[model samples]
Target chain A: MSASLPSTSPFPFPRFYNFPPFFSRQPTLQTHHSQLRKWSTLILNYCRHHRIFKLSLIDALDTELLYNKSLDKRMGIGEVREVVEFMRKEGRAEWAGEGGKGVGGNEVWIWWRNPEEWASLFYEWVDDTAQKHTVLTLYELTESEATISQEFHGMDPDLLQKALSILVKRGKAQVFGQEDQQGVKFF
Target chain B: MSRKGVGLAAFDRSRITSAQYASHGNSLRSSHSTSVATQLSVFRSLLQQFAQTHAKDIRSNPSFRAEFARMCAAIGVDPLASSSGAGGKDGGGSFWAQMLGGSVNDFYFELAVRVVEVCGASREENGGLIGVKEVKDRIMSTRMEGSSEITDDDILRAVNTLKPLGSSYSTLTVGPKIYIRSVPKELNIDQSAVLEAAQVLGYVTVSMLMINLKWPRARAKTAIDDLVSESMLWVDMQCAEWEYWSPGFMLGTGDDG
Candidate 1:
């Protein structure tokens, strides 16, 4: 089932998206590799366009990202898994589970921007706003009206923490408080 | 009696007249060659002047460039012929490199490089075979707006310019369409036939091939299998009958997507 996205403009799919055979897994090794590459790019772009942080493969199977409704062709679940596995190797995706052991998991974190990139964005925003020394609760940083216009606004809390941990390790920020109510102070 | 003693004198007169005729012929031959050389020099200067004036058009205008190349061909001048060995008049480089200051030659060379890049990028997908139009589209799409347009003719000429390097790039005709094949692979008659049939609807089934080409089921299957192995065709198994598709169709039929 496709996500009921905002009534914004639909994604402009690449020309190959309309090619019927793109839905099927190519038998040739080279062709299949190329197909996977295209799929990976398309998936990343689609998620970014929709502001999708994590993807459920089964849910996306019927979406335009993996299905060509006009041609009545859809990528099979195994093929989708293969493409996700390819993206995992490229470091653009990760299976959504603890300890990176989500083998055969149906959920994936499509890293349109990796956690490090998200960390830099957060640091830049804090620096630009001159809020360097001010303590900001994790909830305030992601859900505050002040960050409404920011790209990281309403980000998933776990992913935001992962990003914040990078800044913490770098000594650019300090995190203190309970796990559910942590606060951050950037320097 | 006095006239009868003139036989030796007559022979001497005949010899003198023959000597005069030989000298006159020599002078005439020398003058004719000089005049021909002058005409040739005049023509060369005129061509040079024309090329100098229209250098920009030759580089930017596709038809104008084609016509200019045709004129050179008509005059038995190879504009792209490198001047290194046979014709040492220019010392080194091609005729175009010498006359129009290499703009025209550079244009083709640049286009050839783009062609090679496009072919290399898509080699894994199409198995090193791509439609000439597809190559042009790929190149043009990456170009900025208001850039000069490229035609299929220019693409073909660009491929020809790659011959000196002994590249595997060459053009082949399959069913009414011309393709630039960058690999050294050869397709048998049956594979070509299947490919040609696939052009009709972007795909071909064994039954379709069997019915249309009067091929037995085994023969059609073998041809399709051969193409799939070459990566030239992708098989769609979701259909009622497995459909073999031409990868070239990926570029042709998806504009609305």
Candidate 2:
């Protein structure tokens, strides 16, 4: 007895979005399983489109992430953590503190792209730009107008380092930093 | 004459098969005809013999008890329906009471009472709602180590019989889920309708209730919260759309938990 609902959702919510139980956590095992899957997919897609890296649970609670305005329902912090944790297990998200499982961080990093994928993209860009054997400051690679069109442009430096290191291991890039400046050079 | 083997004064084959129904003038058919009473007596004697011979098996095996009970029923005997016949001054009802426990009916009554006691609550307390499957599991588990198995029909029958106790104990339907309400809690039509919508998946959230019931946020929350406050439900505050679960419907309502 699912409910019938139609709305102008920013994201493609599943048909079950109208089903009341979809909003509530299911008590029965079989139903709850599908519910978890739906929540995980929602989190992944929402994060990818919104480019959400560090998502604060408290803020999400007020946003459509936790409370669907059209539906007028509120998801408790417990369920948010649960779905996000599910994403974490799938390598789609993680606790905002980088990797610690510390209690109640109330935030997560939605990693739609794995470090390996990012590294490959970075390597491909280096080749296309014909920048082999040229040195560029880490800041230039991130904030430079020339890289603005790239998907990883303005990326988190820590994540950038992770990607760049992958290239380094492949003999395609090297990172060097003086007391004043950090630079990465492509081979 | 030695009254051996049921000690019948005579083995009257003509009496059974209703020989009386045969044309009295035609004695040829009389030998083949038998009466219903005679057939029933023969069945009764044989049943008593079986019960006496396999007392231990009948008492230890649920299927065996069910079969025996079925046989007794076919003979128009209820081993546990009443305490007025068969088993002497103790008024032990039928042979069933003497053979089994008090009676099969008593077993079901005990099951019904225990179910209500464990899950029942007033409207203020969460409206004594329970999952039908869970009740069945609990009843089965609670049976004596070796007793007849109870079926869904038995549970339903027991609950139906509870009407004399009042509306406080009754079975109900909300969509596909069957719930036993054991209290005077007033679940409104809106709530009932909302529950009906969610019964397929065994849960409902405030947002879902709001949409399904066409109620305002405040109204939806009030209804769901009312249910939560009453141990009638367990809140699954794990997702963005937090849900409520009837404890009986929950997955891991277990010992490690």
Candidate 3:
């Protein structure tokens, strides 16, 4: 597959995806399996290009991937699990454990674009800044820096640290305590 | 807890066909009342109406209330009333309420909930009431894809099963919707042998709507595909992957059924 970012078709995109099965997961083994592959590829490709960090599975029910009106039929827990389990099998997703029993009620964290991508983002972000040698707290890495921009929006608080920690573990950046509870600075 | 069903006694799945005049021919022959003959006459007339109006589409058509009443009278109340209805203020409304209210068995409840939530193409110019033609059209449209092989008859049959469950054949209204009233509070099909086939079968192969009712997954993916091709669960096509959001799911399989 040529990964050079398929030709940037025209605006408003083609509305051809209105087919019913396009919304429903095929019940057949081969079809469902293929459906999963297509979904995962699309999800992963989008995240990689845009650098999306954490994705809540609940967020999957949007107009972007699924138009709300078309959902005339919603996904049941078992169906959602089948897809999530598929994602989990690959290192692409994890259960956030914030909701009720099973992964159905819980939020799923998609690592389709994992912390490694974030680490790369952090490096690029740091490289573009004039404050290369300057130290800043974790909070600043998230918000205060001009380089962070909108990319940090929705990144989980815990996950944000994990992403930063990856950078720390790699010796690309150093994190040390400064003043009190908020005393984290990346150098 | 007994998982409630009409059993083969209430209605046999394999027996009924489009040309069959009496759904309860054997039961009618057994009854020795003169009224039984009259009832058969009425049953024949209703069946004729059903065949004329729907042909094979009889399944989703409104339950023939007159025939159902006769069947109730024939089978006696203990069987029909006990499992099916709740003693209530209104006759039709109460039974309808019970059907819509809730069930103890996790299986059927799963199915009911899915039906309530399923949204298909907007067909009704007059609100959500999908015309029989529209419903058939949607199913037929999918067939051209060369993937799903389900026929309109299969969908109609599945919908017919919901007749007793409360689907307004004419206007798809809001209030007084039908729901499953009697599922076992603690019956475990996973532990039984007779129902083991249905129990182990994947949710897809079980009747389209029935698949939601504590049905098992299919033995293989091919079976599930066949179920879809048959249109047993077209309304549920999109979310074939997800399960319900139940507190019962919180517990493990070993928990009380």
Candidate 4:
């Protein structure tokens, strides 16, 4: 089963990933906290490496991120939730649903870069290209040929909207049109 | 009595002989001390020259450095000894620091700082008791490629250099492995035994301890619990019988998965 993982340049797992005890929640308070810290770092690095912006706890269970097929050790859903909750407290993760507690949520936003960071990137790109006064549709900003080399390119539209909303709030950019087809004009 | 002369003349002659003897002994003693001082100065200069010439090798080569340290120890010269107490005459710093232009002492001092960092950072994970090899690996891993290689011996020396600071950092030997214990905590006999058993398989269950050490179940459980509370052991509940793992195992299994 371990052999079936895509061998094309896999994400380098930390040494402790093979440690069986890492899958089990430590009973000791300090050890558990340390375990959580390692898990948090691994999750962030893994998502950033794969360019994964959102994670579904259920789907991730079957993946190598949560399961080590070689060791036959897998983190249970509750354990994974606890890790996500830990990340949430650190502001590195958030539940996908609005006004929904993360306790029952299956999906989460892994904020490798928080909205403010993404907004700044968008602002910098606009400023660099002298497109400050030009109007760009949400699709054009993320999917356009000009932005193909951007880190924020091919970003999730919902996340893109959230980032643009920050710019709008700062009066750095203005947003208009329908929710599905929004046009942004940066100042 | 006639050959020796009268009493007053005999007394004067005896006094002159005694004065002559005292002068001759003072001259001999002064010459002996002068030669000894000359030999010591020659030895000091030769040692200084050797250190100056091989300073680079001393810093870059771990074995050469260790051999040099051992040679100093054999001669009753402490290379890492702080000169603070004797600095009034020779300025401040260590003996080696002055002789080698501070490179050798600085090298160990810098390495000691790194060792302290690794211990402090992993204290929460391993309860401030970390394997010497693990500490070396941690330090080497963080170093840049092509940098000087650090050995376990070097780490031991670095820890030794921490003695003057009165820090709790000390080396310990448990079950054939030397560990750097950063917290001033002591392990009981049973706890150490369980730790030794865990070294074999990277972990040990209460049943394993009970059967191997002829320990009762309660005795085994207490030792494991003590280690767990100290954060020295992490308990894995996924197995049928919970296995207590030594955090040292985290760095040992690099080939798996």
Q: Of the candidates shown, which would achieve the greatest TM-score relative to the real structure?
A: 1
Q: How much does candidate 2 score in TM-score? A: 0.41
- What is the TM-score of chain A, computed separately for every candidate? 0.91, 0.80, 0.68, 0.91
lDDT string, candidate 1, B55-154, tens digits: 9999899999889988988987767664323564666755557788889888988999999999999999989999999999899989999999888988
Worst 10 residues of 1 chain B by lDDT: B82-91
DockQ of 4: 0.46
Where does model 3 exceed 4 Å of error? A1-17, A41-67, A98-105, A148-150, A178-187, B1-257
What clash count goes with each model? Answer: 0, 18, 34, 0
Off by over 4 Å in 2: A1-19, A98-104, A178-180, B1-257
**Preferred candidate (TM-score higher): 3 or 4:** 4
- For each candidate, the alpha-carbon lDDT, in order, equals 0.88, 0.65, 0.43, 0.88
- Please tell me how candidate 3 rates in CAPRI terms: incorrect
Q: Put the candidates in TM-score order, highest first.
A: 1, 4, 2, 3
Model 4 lDDT, residue A8, Cα: 48
> Model 3 over residues B1-257: C-alpha lDDT tens digits?
55765577536643555226474675566675677788866865564454345422222232442243345457453212333445553564443223323221122233233323331223111122232333443444444464323333333333434446655422221122211112112212331211223223222233432444444444333343433332222213445453211111111122121
For candidate 1, write residues A126-148 as lDDT tens digits: 99999999999999998888886
Better candidate by DockQ, 2 or 3: 3
DockQ of 1: 0.58
Over A118-186, each residue of candidate 4 has an lDDT whose tens digit, in order, gives: 999999999999998999999999888888767777788888988998999999999999966889999
Q: What overall lDDT, based on C-alpha atoms, would model 4 receive against the true structure?
A: 0.88
Instruction: DockQ winner between 1 and 3, please give it.
Output: 1
